[model samples]
Target: MHAWAMGAAVLSVIASGAKAEEVVLSPSSAWVLDYGDHRCRMTRAFGEGPTRTAFMLEQTQPSDTFSWTVAGPLVDRFGKGKVQVQFAPAFDGFEIDHDASLRVAEFGTAVASVTHEAPPPTLISRTAKPRLRSEPDALSDGTARAARLRLLNPEHGRSIARLTLTKGGESVSLSFGSLEAPFKAMNACMDDLLVSWGMDPAELREATTAARWINSVPLVGKIQEFYPAKALEEGAEADYRLRVVVGANGRVSRCHMILLSRGSDFAQRVCDIMRREARFEPGRNAAGEPKPAFFSTKISYRVY
Candidate 1:
C-alpha cells in the first residue's frame, strides 16, 4: 500500500454549511500541539499554502470531547443542511449541524464551529455528559479516536498520518506520518490540564462516581434568551463548553467557560445561569460518600 493509504485517518467535519465549490484541501503542515492554561489544542493545516484551512482539536480537562473547528477562507462557502465527518477503517460516518458556524458567508478568514451532538466525542458538539449509553449510542468519535490513539503503540504506524476530508463531494486528504509523538504530547498535556483543574489524573478515571446533571432543562430555556447580539447579527453559532464543579452536597459550587465556538461573548450569561439553576447529583468517592467532583459539558445555545 502507498504511504497515503497506509494508516490514513481522516478527521473531517463541516466547518461551514454553504455547499463548497470545487475545492480539495490537503495537508500542508505537521500537527502542532498547544498547552494552554485551560485547554489542550492540536492543530494541523490543510490546503497546500497560506494555511487556508486549518483543523483544530482542543480539550480542557481530561474528557472525550474537542472544540473541533475548521477555519479558512473557503469555509463560508460550504452549504447548509446535513454533512458527515468520517473516521475511517472503523465506521461509515456521522452527521454534523452546518446551519451555523462558518455560515456567516462573509469574505476573509471565516471561522466555523459546528454544534455536533458529539464533536471529538466526533470535532465538536454540544458536549454531552460522560455516561454509559446502551449499545452504540455510546460510541462517540472522540471516544473512538482516543481509544485508537492510546493503542497506537505496539501497532505504531496503525493510527495517525494523512487524514482525509471528504465534504460536499470534494476530497481533501492529509498525509500524516506516525502519530506516536504528537499523540503522546497531546495526552501528556491533557493530564496536566486535569491537574491544573485540581483534579488528579489517575483518580478521575473512576475515582468518584461520575457527576450527574439532574435538573438542567429550566437552565437551558433561560440560556436561549442570552444569545450574543453580535453573534446573532453575523449568523454565527456556538458549542460552548462549561466546567461545572459539583459539591458533595449535590449542588453546583461554580462554573467555568472552557471553550467558546463563536467570536462573541455569551459564555458569562450561560455560566451564570448554570451556576444558579443547574443542579446535579454530586459525585461520590469509591467509599460511597459524597465527594466533590467536576465535569465538562458542551452546551449548544441559540436565541429561539
Candidate 2:
C-alpha cells in the first residue's frame, strides 16, 4: 500500500473515536488503534519491498507528554548508544539521550523508544563532551531516505516529526506516508481520551512566558573558529535558534537547538560553543528579584 494511504487509514481510525478498551483496525491497512486506561495510541507499519518500518505514539493520562516508538529491520542492527533523529524541513530534530534497548517482537522486529524528557545534567554534559571531528560521514548507501511522519499533540499543538535515525555513525530513515491525517486523527483520539478521563481539555494548553537577555554574550569568535569547513566550502548560510536556561548566577545551565537551518552537527556545535563561552547577567522576575530564566535567540551564519 502507498505510504500516504497507510497514514490516511491510521488517521481515519483515530478520528473514529474508539471507546475505552476497544481496538480499531483499518481495512486492508497496517494501522491499528486502541483506546483505554486513560490513554490513546495508534500504530502503523509501512512496508517497502521486504522492508517494514513501524511507528507508534502513546500518550498517557493526565500528562501532556507522549512516548514515540520506531521499530524496523534497520533498527535491529543498531548498537547501544545515542541516536540522533532529525525531522525534515530542517527544524525539528532531537537526540535520544539514553541508550536504546532492542525489543524482539513476534517477527523479530527491533524497536526503540525515545521519551520526551530532558536528559540529566551530568549525562548531557558527558555526551556533549567536545570531540574534534571534521565533517560527518555522508550516507553512501542511500540509507537516509524514508517517508517522514509527524505526530501532533492536540492539547498543546506541539508536534514531533520522526525523520532519520543516526546511531554509531550509521543513519537510516524510517518510511511513512502522509502525516497530516494521522496527526489529526491522533489529536482527535487524544481529545476524546481526555474527556473520558473527566479532565478539562484546557489543562493541556501550553503556557508561554516572556524573558529577555539581561546581558549579551559574544559568540562570533567561537562560531568562526568552529564553523564546519565543508559548510564554508559550499558557502552554506543558515539561521539557528538556541533555547537556554540561565541560572541566577547569570550562567547558562542548559541549552539546545530548538530550530536550525542546517544539519544537526552544526546545531550541536553552536550549542556546545555557547554553553562553554556565553555568560549573561541574571534576568529578574516581575518582582525585580534575580531568578533563573529561559532565553532563546536566533543566530545567523554566513560564509562571507
Candidate 3:
C-alpha cells in the first residue's frame, strides 16, 4: 500500500543482482485492503522504476469522510510549488497553491497539501526584532493540510478516468481504473474497521484452519531479468496480481491473473511463468491433512 513497501520489494530484487536471458514485465491492477492503528485503507499501485506510484484512500472510525494520498516518484517531480489539477470529461482545472516536499529516505515520495488559511509564525524570528506583518499567509510546508481533501469530491463527479498535474512548463498525466471497484473495497474495509472497534474482547482472533507456507520461493530476481524487451523499449512498467492455487502435492495447480496492467505479450509471458515455474507446499487442515490452498501476490517490473 505504501511506497516504502513497494520500494523495498524492488530493492530486494536489485540487491540480489541476478541476470536472466530475457526480461518479463508484470501486469498491474491489484487492490489491497489494509487495517491498522485505528485506520482502514484501500490501496493500489502502478508503474516501475522511477515512475513507481501508489494511491491510497483511507478513513478513520467515527468519520464518514475519506482522505487520499498519491505517493511515488511521479508526485516528486512537481517539487514544492503551485500545480494545476485537471480532471477528464470536463477538463476543468483547479489551482492548488500547496507545498510539495520529497521524502527521499522514505521511498522518494512527496506530499501535496493545500495551504491553510491562518498559519502560525515561524519558531525562530529572522530579524533582531520581531517584525509583524499586516497579513499572515498559510503554512504550506507540511502534509497536515493536504490530508483534508476529500477523495470523493462533489465537483469532480464520479468515474474520473484521468488526472493531469501541471506545474509551469512541466506536466504529467496518470490513468485511473474505474472508481466502482475501489469504492466498493473501501466500504468493505470500513465495515471491518467498525467491527474491529466494537469487538467484545477488543482483540480479534485469527481465523482457524488457515493455510501455512512450508517452502516458498523468491521470484523477484527471475522476474526482473526476464522483463520483456518490447516493454523496455516502450518504457512501460506494470504491476501484476496473480492467484496461485497449490495442490496437496506441493505443486502449483493453476495460476490466473486477477489484474493486468495492460494487454501485451509481457503479461501473457508472466502468467505462463507462474503456471510453469511457481511451486508451493500444500496447506494443512486442523487434522494435519494436506489440502489445497490459494495464495495471491503482486509483482511489478520496471526498466531504468
Q: Which candidate leads in TM-score?
A: 1
Q: Tell me the spans in candidate 1 whose CA falls farther than 4 Å from its real position.
A: 1-28, 50-53, 65-67, 71-84, 95-160, 167-169, 214-238, 276-279
lDDT of 2 at 216: 35
Total clashing residue pairs per candidate?
Answer: 23, 1, 11
Top model number, lDDT: 1
TM-score of each: 0.61, 0.42, 0.40
State the local distance difference test value for candidate 3. 0.45
Residues forming the 10-long window of minimal summed lDDT in candidate 3:
133-142
Cα distance off (Å), candidate 2, residue 84: 1.4
lDDT (0 to 1) per candidate: 0.52, 0.46, 0.45
Compared with the true structure, what per-residue lDDT tens digits does model 1 show for residues 1-304?
A: 0011112334333333245434545555666777787777777666644435776666665543334666665554445555555434333456666653442222234333322354342112133232212112112322322222121131332454444444565534334444456555656787776666666556555443556666655554455445566767775655556677677776777678755655456578767777777776665556676666665655554433
Candidate 3 lDDT by residue in tens digits, 1-304: 2221211122101111133221111214365777654456666555567656665666543222454566766576677768776555444676776466434343456453321222221111111222111111111121222112123333333455655566655555445524455555555554454454332111112112323333232443344446566766776655444445556675666665533234335556656765667665445444555555444444445454
Model 2 misplacement above 4 A: 1-30, 48-50, 62-65, 97-100, 107-115, 119-162, 200-304
Q: Residue 186 lDDT in model 2?
A: 60
Query: For candidate 2, lDDT tens digit of each residue in 214-261?
Result: 323245444545656776667665655455656667677777664333
